[model samples]
Target: MELLYEEAGQPCFGLPSALATAYGGDLGFTTPCLYANFVTSIDGVVALGPEYPSSGSAISGREPADRFVMGLLRACADAVLIGAGTLRATPGHLWTPDHVCPQAAPDFAELRKKLGRAAQPQLVVVTASGDVPTEHPAVQSGATMATTANGARHLEGRLPAACTVFVAGERPVLRMTDVLAALHAHGHTTVLTEGGPHLIGSLISESLLDELFLTTSPVLAGRTDTARPGLIEGFELLPNRQAWTDLISARRRGSYLFLRYRLRSSCGLGLGLSAACRKRCPT
Candidate 1:
C-alpha cells in the first residue's frame, strides 16, 4: 500500500521498495520489531488538555496531519503494544484499516477477520502493576494484557474471560525485553510501541527500540515543564553506542513534519570496521 505524508507544503509518498531497504537488517535477526518514538512540542504535552481530544479542542482533534502519519504507522505494524498507563489515558480505537466489531458476540468475528486470524496482529497492553480496569475499552475489545505472573493473577478477577493475559516475567515491573521476546516467540515480529514519554524513555534506556517515527507539530505548547517533556530524562547514549537512526522518509502534511528513521545495528560494529579497512588496504 502507498503511504503518504506531507513535507514542506508538499505531499510525499513512501514507496514500498524504499521501506524495505530502510528497514532491512541481519537476515538472522531473530525478533525484528518496530518501535515508535515521538515528541510533542517543548511543553510536556501529547494532548491539549483533560478532554484529550487530540489537541485539547473539539473543533480540531489531533492535527489531521499527525492522525494520518499515525494511521500509516498502525497500518504497518503486526501488533500494537502500549503501556497500561497509555491505554488508561488515551483509550480509543486501537488501530486503523481494521474494522471495529462493536457488536457480534461469542467471538469478535469481524474484528478477528480484520486482524486476519484468531491471533494475528493482536492488540496488546503491557503493565507491571496490572492496574488496568477490566471495564476499559481496550480490554473490552479483547486486547490481551501482558504482565508478570503475579500481576496477572492479581488482575484475574477483573479481567474479562475472553481476554488472554500473558505473564512476561516474575518481577513486579514488566520487563520490555521479556515482552518483546515473548511476542517474537509468538510470531508477532513486527511489533509497534506507542508511548507516553516515560515508557518510551524506559525502552530507550534499555536499548530495546528498533526504529522511530516522529511527527513534529507546528504549534508549540508553552508549558515546558508540564506540556513538553523530553523523550527521556538524563538520557545519554555512550560513544559509538549512540543510536544510529537514519532518516529514511520525510513528509509534510499541513502543519506537521512526518519523519521515519531506521535504527542501525550495533551487532556489526567491529566486523563492519574491519571489513571497511580490508577493502581500503592494498592487496
Candidate 2:
C-alpha cells in the first residue's frame, strides 16, 4: 500500500506503529460523523446482486491492501453500521477490524484501547423489514438491530438471546436520520458503514454521510438481469439533487486505486434537509 496524495487539515488518530507502516500514512476521522467504505469494479459495479455472495470481496478480488484499509477504517470507528442485506450476504463474516485483516489485529486493539473504545466496535444492523438471516454466526454472536415497529413485531422472540432490537421508526422506508439519532443517543458517535448501496443511498439522500473511501478494483462486472448495483441505489441524485465530492486522498496498491472523497453539501435537501430531516441529521 502506498499513499499517492492526501489533503491537509484532516483529523489524525495517530495510528499505532504497525498500522501506520502498512497503511502508508496516518488515518483518523472527525468525531460524531458517519463515513462509508466500498469497493467498486472498474466498470462501476459494487455488487453482483443476491446470487453472488460476498460481492465486495469478489469485486476487489480480496486484495490485501483493500482488506487492510477496511480493517483500519473499522478500527477507527466506534461502531460498524450496515444494512441487513450486507449482513445476509456474508453469513460467515464478523463486522470487526481484525476479521478482514488479522495481521494488524494487536495494533488495532492498541488503537481502540488508547481511544477508549470497546474491545471491538459495536456491530449495528439496520433493516426496515427485520428480515435478516437470524441464524447467521454474527447475529448469534451479538449485534444491535434497528428496525421498524412492524419489523420488530415480526422478529419478536425469534431473534437470539444475544441480539437486541430497537424500533427506530414506523416506516415503509426509514429516514436514516432517525436511525443515526438513535445510534448517537447510544454514544456510537464515530460510525463506519460498510454499506449495501441502498443503505448508503439513504444516508446520502439525507445528507448524513461525511466521507467515502472507495477502492476501484481493476475489473469489469458486467450487468445482467441479476440486479447489479453501483455505489448508490434506492434513489437517484442528478440534475435536481447532487452530492458532489472533494477528493481528500488517494492511494494505490497494484491495480487497485484507493480514493477518499468528502461529499459536498447539497442544495436540494430532499425529504432529508427539509421535511424535518435537516434538524435531525447527525452532526
Please give, for residues 209-252, the per-residue lDDT of candidate 1 as tens digits: 76677766666566534443455543666674576666655655
Model 2, TM vs. native: 0.92
lDDT of 2 by residue, 124-151 (tens): 9998887988898888888989888888
Each model's C-alpha lDDT? 0.55, 0.85
TM-scores for candidates 1 onward, in order: 0.68, 0.92
Clashing pairs in 2: none
Q: After superposition, how far is residue 254 of candidate 1 from its true place, in Å?
A: 2.6
* CA deviation > 4 Å runs, candidate 2: 170-172, 266-283
